[model samples]
Target: MKNLLILSLLYITLQANAQGLNERVIKLTDQLDSIGVATFEANYSHGLRTEYIVTVSCELYDDSPAPIKYQDQQGNILSVTPEQDKRIRDLWRRSHESYDLIRSTSRLLAEEGTECYIWESHRNGIDSLLYSVALRDFTNQQDKTYMPDLSTNPEWSKYGGAKEGFILKANPSRFLPNNDMEAYKKNRFQPKSEISFTYRLTVEEEDEDTVYYVDYKEFAGMIDKVLQTDGVKSHPILITHDKGAKVEDFKSEIISCDITHPDLDGETHGTVYEIETAELANTLRRLLSAEIGNYVDRHRNLNYLYRPLQDYSGDMRGMFSSNNWVIRTEFHTKHWYTFDKNLSCRVLLHHVGSKAYVLVLESVNDFWLPKDWHKLKSWKNGVKEYLYLQL
Candidate 1:
């Protein structure tokens, strides 16, 4: 009697929430008498003739989340015994298995290729009978668990990227290496073959299909305009790991590519911009001078300042080379670029193929150049080796 009353109360609660939806959807609920759960949606159209459509769904399987507990005579809560725990675990697993079986049942029905029974309903009640269930194009739709298609432009399929998902243009073209994330982080400056602007498709959720790229023309314009500067030789090529999928479940077009330079080793020569003008030389001189002056000013009072040029010691280290018109720098790395950190410069003018003076600051803890110290050591060394005028 006590157990019967408890079951009766549970039935009332289930009926209020689901109204026999579980029994209607599943044919073999006899074994699931204790813990089955279900939900449903219904539609009704009424006039002299009535029409209705009903869709039912079952809850996902879960491990036993709330096991039965008891209140002791002293009012403290107590856990179930070992035997009861075992039974609860079994019951929970059964519910989970049942839910999974129901989900796969639709796939099984498709394979069977025929309907055992077909029923339709009207406003009054289920009355009309229909035959045949059309199979969805699972290959094209990919996954139907989530909603798809919120595209504003119908012609988005012609361009690269998705047609209905999220896509953003990286202004400076930052590529995240998706093929191997670890390797990418370690050697991210690998040279890229393609020099064109890239538009990457991004996914917000797993089920979202067809990501689209807007403002493709606008972004293209930004990348090309930078090259119009005088004596601008080249721009940095980008290569990254990207998880962005394209709209080519059918056919995809490669929108961007770089023409490889046969002689250039991309790893050491990975720079974002290239300047070939005399202005490039001038700018390097001014920047170095300013930074060196700041460093000497800061550490002039230090007792053990190892002035390389003993005669030009004190606050005149940076000043000695400021008057010179020529400055030498590494051909490959002078143009190299990284995301944020400073580039390593080498003292070499052989690649420049012209009269040039190089700067190499071997060690300057006493100076404040950050990493701006060029490779040229002293002005005197410029007169000795690779000298092209000490100024």
Candidate 2:
């Protein structure tokens, strides 16, 4: 009778949470529409009896060509320059025309479920955005049998300290090595390539928060073995963790090294190391900077900060046009054409401790299109690389 009562109470709690989620989705949709979103689609389904999954997509209206007076540093309308209008139009012509698709699927499981989202623009290429969210059920009011054990799994074991909290996992495929150099050279444009990889990590709950860590070195070593036979470039690596965690709780460092012809462009070369508490942030920052530097020359753009994995709805909205003029706005921020013009390629780095992964999310593909072709091509060529040092 006691167990029956407990189960009934748990059902009520889950129902309430699901209803709350529905409300949240409604609000989110409204927010997108207010920002000039034109089309939106979503799906919600039950995973297990107590778990669910939600997916969302929105097509935003673009207003890049709207004319406005230029403002000076003092916030004064310095002049009504038509130059801005022309610039906006030029950008629209060169800009890829396609839907900016972002897909985020959330899974609410027992113990603490996981939610992740990927944001990628069709104009940017087929590569999608990837992010994750984790939750913890503290009430013990949920199902008693639903508790997740982190010790048995090697991935969960790394994050033993986060046993009580939730650990969100991002996609590791975003940071693999690129293997399409020859295709790019032949086409003089970015080549679209598919990426596939497996991720196995552990999470532990601690106090009120969940602490999750990955043995990047081990993962990198695995990648090294796979790429040893191929001519892979020494691209910088990237691994993403949740946004809220304090860096002080983690440590990371390169502890070992190996090389088989380090001078070769695609030769396997790197160091192996560990990341413990406190050093997570600094190490991540350094690794990201190096990775970004390879694509965007640091000497050319000092303002470049590590790119965070953001949802697509926030960035790739539709382009707005009037009287043969078009403008592109990302997340409501007007990006200067110079940024794209100067861009050699857009790379996504997925960092996992001392071992990092790098992938070319998008690259220049101007020469691939026919001169007279009116329509834009949706795919391009790029490679994802996994790196680790031999101990």
Candidate 3:
């Protein structure tokens, strides 16, 4: 009974924490919407003749700090006293803040001619909570000086990533055509634009980042309340062994999953289920999608540039041993030309003699694979299948 009571209390605390996170997200969204409106007005006041679009992408990373430990110059580790530990925890909790504004851009896509303009700006050196309040004050109090009108800056949006304000006017625009500007203008403030928000909680013991919440349509509505322009999706994508494939065509493909296990007879293949109806298939798809999205976003945001994979050769037999369940998935794109566009991803579910299982996922698709793949599991020497989910 005592254990049950403790478990119930723990569950309640977790629920409360989740609720608090949602509240924070809502408050931040509201603050961002206000800033976005002010920014749009600020840009328009400076003669933006074409349709204006604002793309505001914000991310909050909440890291739960580990217990503090002291290390001396002699390389000896020491533990803090109870009182010291409490004080340290309090300080860490107070100092650590979440909510980072990734990038906020207000753009003007040319309506007819080959001209485009953009005002990209971001609040620096402030956490989301403080920035939200401070920016509100700045926008309301400063009025004309809320944000610089960089539309005249000669830099011309050359600085990659939206960290500062700059007006980029291009002749014969090389990017996406402004043909849809009218449609976007019509749909502006409609909240029908595509937007995605993902929340990931990394539990210390799991050592894996798990996406706790993901919403698209609803959050877009919240943002559209202020921007009043067709929304833009902020997720990042890499060419990754391009294979001369288009993103639109690649996303429609499905994954073929096969799990193989050893039986007394010899070897038994796990039953494959229909992806649309099977719970396991759905879970795998969701996990893969979230992982890929997060991975691409992290690399893109950090400006880590790398060449696409040209070729790779490695053996993958040892990781798919008889003792563990080997999960093999093949991603197939629509048949084009004589070559087959197929990629394989293999996962190992190691059984620790009971219900405890360790999962290791790998792929030759270098874009999908992490540099620290070995850190995910102990048995790290074997070649693993590559799994990349475009969706």
Candidate 4:
């Protein structure tokens, strides 16, 4: 009787949550229509039973674009800019259009069991925005009575499946020497490329010669350009890893020298500097274009295994932490019989530990458009190397 009561209560709770979600959606759709949202999509999963994962595409209504707004995972009004709106739209469009191709090639239903709602605006003078949302509902399998006591945490569990496990697990042996197999494998799956363009700057400091591995080559150059440019001081904002510090105002001062890892909870607890000026943001984007192109070419067909766009989303969502600096860009390419519409490039500089400073330039393809749960895979893949970087 107790067990029955418990199960009944659980069902009631789920039903209530589902109803609440629907109500929220109704409210959100009403709110979105006023702000020029052309199309809105919300995805709900069993695990995340409350709020829906939202993606929207917008068109300029009048001479000026309406303010695009939506909710985060926690259902708070997510902070986003016009650029982010466009990026999200483009990503969703590509993912929606090529979803079948991804499934046929990768052999996984990216959205296995989820309820989806899609709304398109029919406001006058606006070209009817078009989009498709695929829905599937798979009944949960019965729990197995017999289970294997795999005592230790299975390393393979971290990957999506056999293919991702194999591709991501394969060591980057080409870069490291064969004789040092242990060391090579230990640092193989770093967030950035195994190859680096090292520069030893002549410093006047008497401290222990700290070694910092920067993820991307472009980071140093971008920072240098930002510092050199005039009028930047007028719009300066301070970025810091200190959570207690207030960033309510912008001044011509930057705090914090280098970014370090997060605490036990994986929270950076830091304040970021938004690129308030178009000039600086555009400069970074322009510089990143060439480098991202090079990365796409080098990785080529292997992009299917190292989906970078998804990785960039992970970075943007803070699945990985590096305090003050994080930049994400997307690219598309068709070359050598390989066509990828969403390639991701994420950049950051991290203070790994007391010993070294590492910069990360992340470039990968969005081969598998896995669900939100897979965001941490990038962080997990490089945890060992990240720890080594700290050492």
Candidate 5:
């Protein structure tokens, strides 16, 4: 009877393992539709191997009555802006100067490390703008640096691997286009604009069991200063918890923290943490909401407008298979503009995991606004309000 009981337990364990694996596969299939399995596979094979993948999609609008133009570093017009000629010209000139500086001074640190260059220029006579260029070499094996290469590799070409390259430039623009001209005039047009480039690289490393997935999105907005005489001094973002907040309180373990451009005041900061369990996850949501609420209340004297989300069945239907969970919060206010009775701010939290892994999605909607500014005009027209009661 004891032997039979032992056999029964073994059978149950096997069945449970099989069930878990099946669930994971189904989740993967569902996520593939949203994130593209091919892209995920390429990143998994070449970049840092992450148990969880987070993809953020954002839409930016140019609401000015003028046209907006975007250009490459080489003065090539990538996007045309007819009405905003002055703004576009200023942007192009700034980009060109920075590119020229990077091309002149940038050099390879090691055979396989990274090289960076910065250029400083002035916009509108008073505002100072800085442009930066960075190139990473993934070919050197002797280097112990942690930066991952996304470019395709010549050696790995036979096995279907590739190396990636990217170039980006940023300058401050008027954050509020029309109504806040006074604030924009005072700041001298210094706000933040971030652009990033990403590609893939292939290298042959032993031990296929160890997957290397380099997350470039996390590296966005990073800024560093080199003394030239000495090595580079990077001022990355610092992550400090509220005195008693323990690692476990975060729901996931904190793996890494980086600050981009600390020299600039009031820049957005980013943190990457991993979640471990569902109970811890519930705690994480509460803590995040409290933190954001405290921040808004302290910084602004605005009343809170909360929009309770509808049932999430459609949005997060197959999250279990991908080992993913998402939480969304929207805060609204009536004071931002003359129109738009309800101006809402939203945040999305994504929790992704594998065995012994947790990834948190914070500040997903931190800097987003409506795509069509004309919508605000409609809000001023004032529509009637209706109320419904549910039994």
Candidate 6:
């Protein structure tokens, strides 16, 4: 009777845990939907205009310590590192600044131009826009900005993996009209948006964050400071979290998931399923493997960056493949996946298990293959069949 009762209890507990995880999965999905995504096109709202406009928001604080030094130095002032100077200036703007600033230097941009939006830090986790200015040439005497007015896809329209690109200074892209070539050639620039920004940011003085209201001159300075400083800028003002997603649900043994694929890119977004149980984590890995195996079969065009991902230089997809193992939060191994052996666009399943975090990096087309290769063939020789999804 005791054993039977214990077994019954275990069954009931497992059922309840599953029910909770399902709820958490739903909440994660809701959070993604609520936080939303930002997308913009040249024809979209306020992307371009004939008028010169500038907007600013600076709130005066009634409480907190009176404004102190924007840059606090102890020993020799010259000894202060650039990073330290930035921290001091940033804190002052958040805590001390009283005035508001706004300016519109737009003149020749009426036809086509780039606009820069300035955002400033605020108190209690609040950040407000310092101002926005339009540039006629996307370049002025001091700085150069990339204009999207003439381009089909501008910075404003970027979402997901699309945001991390480079702003290359080159001749007009193929998207530009042949007639406009002469004009575009006179002043040439291109954009390469990318995934990672300067990783040099330090959060040492994060506690000093406060709100700043700005004046036109101060607003201009704020813009210049962000452009010049490496790690001074905070998160974008427009990005905000609506409600918190409960983490408890995903940590349960039920293998809750909150994953999304923007589809425009070959990557997945927001995998926040937290697993505490080792057994549960293993099960989740199997589930992920199965799902990914299915995904690869359907999406044969997928590519991996490097082949023989492990140094062994052999078939890595095999289970017993000798990839180096390291101990961390959990047992982990990374393998590269691709349609063919060519290195272009590929997905890397990093690599995770207990506290597992799966990362799907960018993919590229197999450019090395012969041009006459058939798309539907199992292999180049039409002999062996592709078994990617069967895994």
Per-residue C-alpha lDDT of model 4 across residues 1-391, encoded as one tens digit per residue: 2333334323322533443323323343345444433222212111112122323322121121334446654658767787878775554444333322222222222223132112234332222221111222222232323222234523223221111111111112244454344553343221111111000111111233222212334443444443344333212111122233222222322232221222211111111123334444334333333343333323322211111111122222232233323333333343232233323334443221221111223333321111111112222211211212332
Summarize candidate 3's per-residue lDDT along 4-45 as a digit string, tens digits: 333432432253344332333335445654443111110110
Clashes of 5: 37
Candidate 5, residues 102-138, lDDT tens digits: the string is 3222222112224323344544322222222222333
* Residues 77-120, model 6: lDDT tens digits: 24566677556545434422212111111111111224444334
- For model 2, residues 268-366, the per-residue Cα lDDT tens digits are 122222222223423332333333222222122122222211122221111111110100001101232222221112222333433333332211111
* Model 2 error, position 69 (Å): 2.4
**What are the lDDT scores of the predictions, listed in order?**
0.27, 0.27, 0.26, 0.28, 0.28, 0.24
TM-score of each: 0.18, 0.20, 0.20, 0.23, 0.21, 0.17
Clashes of each: 20, 55, 4, 19, 37, 31
Q: State how far residue 93 of model 6 sits from its true place (Å).
A: 37
Q: What is candidate 2's local distance difference test score?
A: 0.27
What residue pairs clash in candidate 3, if any at all?
362-385, 363-385, 363-386, 364-386
- Candidate 2 positional error at 83, Å: 9.5
Q: Show where candidate 6 strays beyond 4 Å.
A: 1-147, 156-342, 348-378, 381-391
Please give the distance, in angstroms, between residue 350's alpha carbon in candidate 4 and its true position after superposition: 18
Task: List CA RMSD, all candidates.
Answer: 30.3, 24.1, 25.8, 25.3, 25.5, 28.4
Q: Write the candidate numbers in order of decreasing TM-score.
A: 4, 5, 2, 3, 1, 6
* Worst 10 contiguous positions by lDDT, candidate 6: 38-47
Residue 66, candidate 6: Cα error in Å is 53
